[model samples]
Target: MPLDLSRRSLFTGAAGLTVSGLAGAGLAGCSQTAPSGTTDAAFPPGAIDPHLLGPAEGVALLSRNENPYGPSQSALDMIEYAASKGAYYANQEAAVSLMSMIAEKNGVDPEQVVLTTGSGEVLSAIAVLYGPRGPIVAPRLFWDTTALYAANLGMAEIQRVPLTDEMEIDLAAIEAAVTPDTGLVQLCNPNNPTGLVSDPATFQAAVRRMAATTTVLVDEAYIELSDDPEANSCVPLISEGHDVIVTRTFSKIYGMAGIRLGYAIASAETAAAIRPVVMSWSPCTSYAAGIGCYNDDAFIDFSKSKVTEARDMVFATLDTLGLDYLPSQTNFVYFKSGLEANAVQAAMAERLISVRGQYMDYNEWTRVSMGKVEDVERFCRALPELIEA
Candidate 1:
């Protein structure tokens, strides 16, 4: 199917789900404690290379793991409308509405959901709220946010586990690494830079084991983009009364990273503990846009389908090149280039294309986000010359 690039008008009266049934379901169980840190004091300016993407007219922008089709027409219109209200600040009403919607959809209580600007805020919060308590354990090639923030807070204990031969986390090895001082264990499902997913049952079992030792944070930023996303999420662990936090985002599948709307799920008490540490707001427009994005199921299905198609084509290309790659369950592929990462990145840059230089313990790897069909075609064409020369 050809992409629907045109804007779709949103129903003015129904920008989001009706507020009729949502009145008494307010999710204010989170403590109103003022977040402990300020931006200047909490986030050190030069913490880590933020790895910001450089998008241009002709650039493929395969570097950052972001959705290419972007939010649906309905979401865009909703954002604009919400912003035009000229509300000077982020709206808690929108957050309340979002929590209600999420709770109802997932069969969880509204108070258990913590809305943040994006999962990144919750990640940083975990560092402050939990990281200072003990050492952090994580996969070396996974999302680097927690490690970076933990360092920014001047806390030095972090253990990076090496991925297996197949680029998957060995749950047993991770369990073995947890010591008495282990404060938190972080996992990014359908992990970035590799895009491999863990079995939910195995993940829950690992959390059950780890919960006895320390808190667990499951960063599901890409879960909705995974195969059988419902089973890939760890939110259910919260219901089982585990000290597990599942952070999610509308950024990947919903194509709304710019909107800055995401959430974290934990026991209501745990959520209250993490909530006070967050400093950013999930803006009024973001909240409104999130609602619109959530309602636009058509766009979500379409984007997922397109991503699968593009991902398969890239895998086929890598096979033709006889290159080995981590079999992906998400929108990207991590492949062996048989060349130095920096050189390949520089070459791709010259072609007005951007990809990542993901260095793993065993090999030099490159990961490319599945982009639009045309962008992927440009990437496939340019990949050979860059890898060879």
Candidate 2:
């Protein structure tokens, strides 16, 4: 029988489940914390410090490319409501509703959508599924989740094409690198670290050509923060039946990184092939947060404005220091630091600021995500001294 996916059925049935009864009978004994005998010191060196998981007070956190202004009031309210039924396994309904929303938003059928714990899961799934077929082709420097995961697992050979002299994704070179045996090609639009977006027409054409022979995975994790998301996205290509998978995340613009909800859009057949391999599903809170903010335009605009402001400030600082940097479309700014990337990262960490150090062979460049305006201001103030030091 087909599932009842109506909003009323979803919410009402979810609310009727007894959390206390379930928790008391089955979950009360479970613990996520360390066992009683374990201590923090028992962990090996480089284990994640729990204290560093959330925001660290007084620290300017610009390392991870996260939206600093997010989890809007609406998302928070929905999450609170969803938490009431947390003990119930609502994964099926939650996945359907979120997938329906994503499909509607992208102008695709629900069958063409595959939700994951995060976009990373889908990327990894694609890598594992296709890696055994043939080699994966990608730009030398882009968000490398799929290729790196496959290579590290000894599943696929990565064929890297260098970026252009201007440090932009060399679309032409990428197209030239594709062979009939190439199983997948990965593209990160408005790429991470560099924050450069390929020209839409050229990118689309290149993707279409590449898709004729192999599957292409476009990671649009930051596309919502770009100057024009619709124009920049390849979702329409999927609608046109291109063998392309475009993955998006609520973590960036929605400020819901902790929520862990994201998805992939593709041709129905392609989506089906990829879905079964995904290892995790998002929970109720993630579903609620995604439902609440998936179309919250006002909050999106506010987040974009603040990110632009912070990015411009970084550009100004780089200008004053006579440093070259890419004009960013995403929230982060990548700039020539004129120092070893590790040294720059260390100096900034000393000042209670966190920024990324290096990517591939770009050892002298630094990538800084847009934090709160005040924190960015602190980074701007400290940069001059750090460069001189």
Candidate 3:
């Protein structure tokens, strides 16, 4: 259901990019955190896979940053209909339609977009196109999955720059690090592990500066959950004809991790460079569900409200327990565990809670994904016991 241009024209103010929020919510490939409710004996249509853990009750999986509320009713109904019809394979036309809407929202030509299994696949494709003994520049302590992808492909070295003391990405440092031989530069706005963002104007200037020497990858997997996803995004950079690629997912905000769908926006030339290398496909069911959710402002608003409630609960508990934490722009928060993070992790695991640790260089830093308010409360109840021991 591609929205008519007349209807699309209605999106102009705060809701301009809100229509596309359902498109790029994000997912970490493995279920480091299972779907919010781990107890039901019966698996739901898009239930969390048992990839990392067996199903059970009262398990709070705050490690994955997944949407606990799940896909909108409209999306769910579409998914159910697709599955009922046994559309086991993906449809090319469906992908075309989905990308058409995404392109319109980003103000780019449809040819400038490409679909991936998840945003993670787009990262891998970028690495595959430009790695295996190339200079990729990135933050020293940010998201590592893409770095790990390059490493596995034998990327010789990634020139790393440290973030500023205030926890924002050091755009100048990154620009300075770019060399004539640099293949790609990565900027994870509202960075992972730190949950902090850089100034958008400064970010765009850096992208323009670095684009001269190398391809820039702006991973905005968590951008939709930001206070103003539109202003913070890099799609505008793409619209202005920069060699930048912005990848996002439906796993986080849209609650479709199990369905596995995401896409990338780039200049037509950059898209052309990466298109042939990607599968050029998304599951038919995923496309249908995405269409159903694309403009569902009610569900998006409700989900954001839920995240706010849960995030506040987490912040309040962190303060009560005398923990120092970074202010967040997304659904999760990063805090100092004080004790051995692994020990805290194991302790919580025993209590049926899963969290994330082992970020770049901090032993005390822990990343906790926002769950339902009650789930965060359970984690808070378990925190004191976990850290004290």
Candidate 4:
């Protein structure tokens, strides 16, 4: 969908105008004072150190595919404003407005959009709702975390199709794997771990063919980072009234992973079915952040450029080391390490860097997400030594 210039201006203006007013509200009576004598001193002796819960300082965290620069200034401003109203439940009108904006941006009816805590909610909801109908068909190796969670609970059965020899998701194989009893078809474009994007035309055509038989869920979490997000998205299929559901997340592009906001576009009926199964509601702060940065093209461009720069560093290092890697269209690179995956992971950890070991049976391959430039530099520097060792 085309960017709404008027909306962009409004967002820019709001970010600039709200600071003093929000500060005044906090300075006045809005700020809450915590009760006295309620500090960490009251905690039990065995309580885990909060620091241990996250990455250690100076560690190059390249394991999780998160946008290193995110929640743009506009989002931060909006989040501040939203926090002042934290005592109250999120305004229903504002929630509706966000859905409307997303609907307008994606060229779908508001009824077709169901907002959730994150796209993970959409995946789990789909699994619970449709998994019992039959088996979920998906590529053998993709981001199957949520699907696997549902399967463990006995809510779904998944039928996996192996990737092509080139490590690309084989749409033909996935299509052939789907039968009359198939519950849903799950696809992650610019698929996770491999980072290979399917041709948009071919992808859409294949989805349409599969949607003819059963619902198809297209997880476009990283579509915005792909070469052509508009063409790569299967969202238009929903407008065409196919049994297709398109999921998107502000977590990846907007850098709002901790904030937890995502949504799905489907036929109004499908959306309705999915909404009931969503486990949690996003806060007003997250909604405000989404509204602020959803149209901030400049920030998106900046983030993508940084990701590209970091990815290039990894690529150049891999080239020098004679390592094989797939040409990536997303924010991470999957490469053949020529050593045991766990060994490489351990070696990187010993060097105070983090990278994924393997996925499924690709034991000699590793996936490293793009981190901050300096952090990626650390990974690149350590990789050569690890490989040589």
Best by lDDT: 4
Off by over 4 Å in 2: 1-52
Alpha carbon deviation, residue 91, candidate 2 (Å): 4.0
Question: What C-alpha lDDT values do all the predictions have?
Answer: 0.75, 0.81, 0.75, 0.82
Tell me each candidate's TM-score.
0.84, 0.87, 0.84, 0.87
Model 1 residue 166 distance off true place after TM-score fit, in angstroms: 1.7
Off by over 4 Å in 4: 1-39, 42-54
lDDT at position 175, candidate 1? 93
Which ten residues in a row are the worst by lDDT in model 4?
8-17
The lowest-lDDT stretch of 10 consecutive residues in candidate 1 is 3-12
Using TM-score as the measure, what is the rank order of every candidate, best first? 2, 4, 3, 1
lDDT at 185 for candidate 2?
A: 91
Task: Write one digit per residue (lDDT tens) for candidate 3, span 8-28.
Answer: 121112222232222232235
Model 4, span 1-389: residue lDDT tens: 33222322212112222333323222101134454555677556878545333456778878888876888999999999999999986766666788889999999877777777778766777877788899999999888877775676676888999999998889999999988899999999979989999989899999999999999999899999998999999999888888999999998878877777888899888877776666555788988988899899999999999989999999999999999999999889999988989889999999888888767778999999897889999998888788887
Cα error of candidate 4 at position 192, Å:
0.6
Query: What lDDT tens digits, residue by residue, belong to model 2 across residues 325-365?
Result: 99889988999987999999999999999988777779999
**Per-prediction CA RMSD (Å):** 12.0, 7.9, 8.4, 10.0
Model with the higher lDDT, candidate 1 or 4: 4
Collision pairs in model 4: none
Prediction 4 TM-score vs. true: 0.87
